[model samples]
Target: MKSVLLALCIVSVSFPALAINRYNVQAMSCASVQQAVKRDGAAILRWQSARNPSLPLYDRYVRNGLYCDPNEYAKRAYVPSQNRANCLVYKCADISDNLLFDD
Candidate 1:
């Protein structure tokens, strides 16, 4: 019983807190955007159907986002405020469509 309790405590202490985050799409590329359907697994993004008439073709794309739980160490380890930024995606950068997460 004592051994088990020690094991549990050590295991918990070693790992960072994993959050069930609703993934946010930081951004997507124009080319990849063609075949893509979602910003993140849970959210969508602006796409070709709504292409802006005035703006020149994009050489790069950018976007933002949300949420997490962290211990003091993790909270400090990350520079961006928790739950305030979305993971970044790139277009025709040949990124895979089935990426599990942006990060």
Candidate 2:
């Protein structure tokens, strides 16, 4: 019993208490912001989308790169004039907007 308890304690402490996958890509240029979104957005969406539908994952979008709005990524519109739209509209959208792949 003591060994089991010790093992459990060790396992718990070995990892972060709150292991959050954060992509703090903020106040960046158009290209940099696009890159960050393209890179991390898909992973974020996958992890978020896999979870229970009741527990939704709230993500933001950088419209004009001045602020980070608490907007659900899926609910955003396609703006042609959008500077960073290439990333959201093309790369991430390629996976999200289309029936590209399941995995």
Candidate 3:
């Protein structure tokens, strides 16, 4: 019974960690991107520059859509230490998507 209780406690502790909400930001610009990062704790910046006159600028991009692909932005932009990832998908946001985990 004691062993079972210990196992249950361990499972309960780890369950929250596994349930973190991982979001992929799609087409975020430079400014609002910062705001999203600050608010959500973590975000993926999907960059899409406008070629035509009808399209919106960088500012509008952040406000309208979500970006995905941190590695792409980190290569060009200045991502902080916590955001920089050695792997393909860089952790661009200093905060974690997981509400439980404090930035």
Candidate 4:
């Protein structure tokens, strides 16, 4: 039992915890938000709703498709930033297999 517990501790300590970076879009310039995603590969961006100021909106943005899961693809998305209302960013989009080919 002691050996098992020691092995468990060693295994747990061997793997480091990974976390995604987050930023408030409203506090950053459009360029800054883009740069953050590019530098970090992915980030969680947050902003307030235009229609409902009290409501908060956020999503995970990626630098490219490499950051997305195999079933998801990177797509263009816009978010409000300090300098631009439609700051360009990439979001992971779901890939639907329902589309039929004409062939």
Candidate 5:
């Protein structure tokens, strides 16, 4: 009974972490992406700006309904404008097949 309780406790502790899945968006520029992320709380895995390869992942201050214009800058670190309609939005669903939770 003690072992079973311990196992249950461990499972409960790790459940939240396991439920959360990181998401990545390919943006036209880091600034735009950052702005959008700041307003959306969406995790930015990488930013492929036109002027740079990629930016390091960082936590952003997201709000709600923040708009981003990818082509606003000539020199950008990412370029999601190339395929705005079909741009890839990376989420846990893309990486895993398990329907355990929604991030």
Candidate 6:
């Protein structure tokens, strides 16, 4: 039982604290929203849709391409914040989208 407990403790300590943060962009200033993503490396920014106020929109924004998957690349995106209609940020997009298809 002691050995199992020791193993569990070691496993817990081996990993860094990588909690994905979520925020309501509408409640935060554009700079605040950007800072959150930069600080966390990645964060889910949520806001209500403009066309449909009842609809919610959210996506994981990243600080840079390093946070994206191998097959994905960072693309410019925007989210609504307290001070701006479109606050610039980056989000992962499928790399295939950039490839040219020859007929």
Per-model TM-score on C-alpha atoms: 0.20, 0.24, 0.30, 0.77, 0.33, 0.77
lDDT of 4 by residue, 23-102 (tens): 99999999999999999999999999999999999999999989988998788899999999899999987867324541
lDDT of 1 by residue, 10-62 (tens): 98877633321222122433334422323432123332212553533222222
lDDT of 6 by residue, 13-66 (tens): 775334678999999999999999999999989999999999999989999989
Best by lDDT: 6
Question: Model 2 misses residue 77 by how many Å?
Answer: 6.7
Kindly give the number of clashing pairs for every candidate. 1, 0, 9, 0, 12, 0
> For model 3, how does the per-residue alpha-carbon lDDT over 33-85 read when each residue is reduced to its tens digit?
45665465444443323355353322111111133344322222332222332
TM-score of 1: 0.20
| Per-residue accuracy of model 5 over 20-100 as CA lDDT, tens digit each | 324344534445444554444444444344555564443222222222223221111222532352333322222233344
Q: Please report how far candidate 3 places residue 11 from its true position, in Å.
A: 0.9
Superposed model 2: Cα runs more than 4 Å off: 1-26, 42-73, 77-103
List runs of model 5 lying over 4 Å from the truth.
Answer: 27-45, 48-103
Order by TM-score, highest first = 6, 4, 5, 3, 2, 1
Quote the positional error of residue 11 for candidate 5 in Å: 0.9
For candidate 4, which ten residues in a row score worst on lDDT?
Answer: 94-103
Model 3 lDDT at residue 79: 25
- Residue by residue across 1-103, what tens digits does model 2's lDDT show? 9999999999998764344234423233446545554554432221122246354443443333223223322333222222442234222223244343532
